[model samples]
Target chain A: MTQPIEKIETPKGERFIIPIGPQHPALKEPGHFEFTVDGETVKDATVRLGYVHRGIEKATESRNYIQNLYLLERICGICSHTHAMTYSLGVEKLAGVEAPPRAQAIRVIVAELERIHSHMLWLGVAAHEAGFDTLFMYSWRDRETVMDLLELLSGNRVNYSANVLGGVKFDITPEQAGDVLKGLDFLEGRNRHYLDVVSNDALLLGRIRGVGVMTQADAERLGAIGPTARASGVALDVRIDAPYIAYKDFQPALITETAGDLEARFKVRVREIEESIRLIRLLLEHLPEGELVARMPRRIPAGEAISRVEAPRGEAFYFIKSNGTDTPARVKVRTPTIFNMATVLSLAKGLQLADMPMILVGIDPCFSCNDRMVTVREAERAETWTWNELREHGIKVYQR
Target chain B: MSNLVDQITAGLKTWARVNSPWVIHFNSGSCNGCDIEILATLTPRYDLERFGVKLQGSPRHADVLVCTGPVTRQARERLIRIYEQMPEPKFVVAVGSCAVSGGVFEGCYNVMGGIDRVIPVHAFIPGCPPRPEAIIDGVVKLLSSLQSPAPVQPIMGPDGGKA
Candidate 1:
């Protein structure tokens, strides 16, 4: 497997271009990568995305705010709540309304729970990518504990549509609060075990330690964010930097590691899960009392707003513009995966071919979250179309 | 005597296909909700393996093709190619509302409707993303249907004869 894939004679030495994915066993979703290697070491890498592109942002323009909430939530399954929450926050900002304190606290609680589930899921997937099925199975089996808690609270496993326009859809009952606390207790213990395993497991350490090392300067230059950056000693977290929802009141301690390798990424995410558990427990202890939702105007005034939230992967950016109507003029989503993707491609150089999967999953890249736009180039010229032009072209093509 | 031996061998093949189906998952244009749930079904909790299901890495080695989400324009050719690569007597299971009827992504420009729009499906599991248990139930029903002494027909969608 470590053998160079496609050999080509270059000016300096023999070069090899290895194409992976768009359909490959290593990738669960479709994405294409062409990595140029000199022997076993990668020299350059290029990524071609858009296979999972469903034109969601364009589709958002045609739907009203209420409908867009559900549509945007599908941007990512692992971080579905982050998409929904980020969109809701942006739309609420434009409407000049905020959820009540109690609702805000509940939002934070759900957000933290989502972070735990997301991190554990990433841990399982990363372990699986490293060929550690035992760790994968154990982490995922334990992840169901949080999944059941989410199902209990929101009535669905994935895409828990927990947020409404002005506030949340469901309130946490006292019994549900007790159940959440019980679940946290179990997860807290398991997370500690995971932290120990990842930090000390000799077999896993061989694959991850000192592999895919991106220094602090490289991370900053590559624009890495979330745990991928924090693992490299960059302390940039949206919640801590600009506290949204109830994060201001109940702040979770920042966790970072300076190793800047796959091991650091694993440690940071696992420790963050421990932090999430503690934060959720604090929110439940001082559970505020109030209505879950506030009235939102059917027609929001014309305005544009930007909202940023720290999703489990990284900072999820949302841009919303209203045109004095129920529907939005435009909607843009910049997921964290795109920012972290550069780090992986850069780190791929000087590493063994066998380490690519581990390095790729180390960033927790979600291809579904990243694929939003497609660029078509034709005959040395690229044509950019406006809304009207694109509409007309669609009509012409369908008519034909 | 030769005809009798052939009948017994064919019967054994049918029984093995029913008891254990090696499935290969393809994500044409899904939001990742259905894809993850499909993986969850194979994990320890839901444990679809207990029902003799194994997730194969290659389409050629697979007996069933489990597709998620609406088929996209870029992925359409690849989907058909994967379906064609599988050996004879292959089954397709379309999971999720999008795969069955294009759900939320129906009118999206790049999306090409449901999986059935590309390849014929034998079972359709519906949900925003069907629960792992429902996925298991769908696969089980599809396998059990093989017990009958008749060839399985492709489950036709609203617009039939696409296959």
Candidate 2:
């Protein structure tokens, strides 16, 4: 059913206000954006997050390391495993214990599988927003293949909770390895079809190409991470740059696209799915043999460690400070979406009202992962102009 | 004759509500897991739509308020606002362990337990992220209770506390 959302015309002047939700249908999560538009062109945009804030960072301070594993996993549903794994990695670093090589390999396997599942889910949602429901249905249907593989290995579908304090919970069996390869085989064919469709489909290309084009310089300056930055040729994949965990052994090729439009972001994600499939197959072949868990102390020594993992959206950074107690003193998370919010707010300026959803999903915004409420001493607010200056300096940026 | 017509129309409303329940989903505070699983049910595989349950985008058009997550401080007012906006005879199905009891987020600074902490819940489906099958079953269970044509009350007490 088509939405009957009415755009009110201000009788005083031509300026119209379009507020897109704390409960609008353009997105699955709640992050409100108000755009002051002139006719069809967007003049200015403002983003208000924290609609889904649950005070996870502060809550982490109270829970012990063992319980916080599951707590942190719920930070973002799509990348729950990445949250748990990243937290465990940091805590392990502080504890001065490395997970067994086999466990590390398992971490990469799960992470890549998650990357595929997440990107596929995003593709379906983005397609649905673009009014192409067929692709949405098709991609989601194919996404189940990877979801099944994840469930087989980790037991749970969404929050795998696979990472233990010192190592992973489950190990891959021969049969599971067979299933992984089988799932990838089916996904490989589907990924190629999707890549072709996103690049060539006339209607899809029209809605995406030359729309929300963020230059490479802009992407870099804005500090966009993951595929959002890679699409603009920024090359900021944390896996390659930092070589965390199994990234050193099973390296992933950085998928970059020169064109930074919505299409480029789409291409970067689709190509990343292809690369994840390749990585999964190789990891399955190597299948390191070792214990899944190492002996970790109940009380971690007093120290601080920062861990970064390449979540499907972008880099998921976790900062853990242990104060010689069972519970951590502070746990800080800087999700990729928070970094891309600047890119999104900037791109939305001067865009048509129709382009807001595309540009918003272009960064694959995850509000729950963000809203952890980190007080950045150095981070400055961009363009805090109230409604007074919103009219005179309502950014007129044109994309060629 | 007037009494008979009134009875028939009320019965029809009950039947229509049970037959096709249009649902509007809200996330007061959730880990996106339950929300995504809820979406998974709408897709072709689980096919909750086969039961004639449509996930409506607006609360105004929805018959059931399907909420996930524990209520958070910031989202409390918005959740209640969405519930209040829906027409009377509305049912609420809170899906997920979090929606049922706040699950892992019970004592967090901003979390206010489950969806029931703010509004009344007609049905509760429990899982870390409940499976699509369980969610379908929960909605069906809620619909089963609405088979009788009693005027659905909001069930708030005189003291503004949960009844």
Q: Write the per-residue lDDT of candidate 1 for residues A166-195, one digit (tens) a residue.
A: 999999999999999999999999999999
lDDT (tens digit, per residue) of candidate 2 on B1-163: 9999998998898888888989888777777888888888888788888888997556778899988888787777877887898998788888899888888988888777888778877788999899888999888877877775453344332334341
Clashing pairs in 2: none
For A1-400, candidate 2 gives per-residue lDDT tens digits of 2211133233444665555544321122356666776766778877776665677889998888999998999887889999999999999999999999999999999999999999999999888767678998999888888889999998989999889999999999999899889989999999999999999998788789999999999999999888999999997888999998888888999899999999999999999999999999999999889899999987899999999988898888889999998899999998887778788879988887667667877898742122111111123321232211221122211122
Considering every candidate listed, which one attains the maximal TM-score? 1
Q: Give candidate 1's chain B TM-score.
A: 0.94
Fnat by candidate, in order: 0.56, 0.61
Instruction: Supply the TM-score for candidate 2.
Output: 0.90
For model 2, the docking class works out as medium
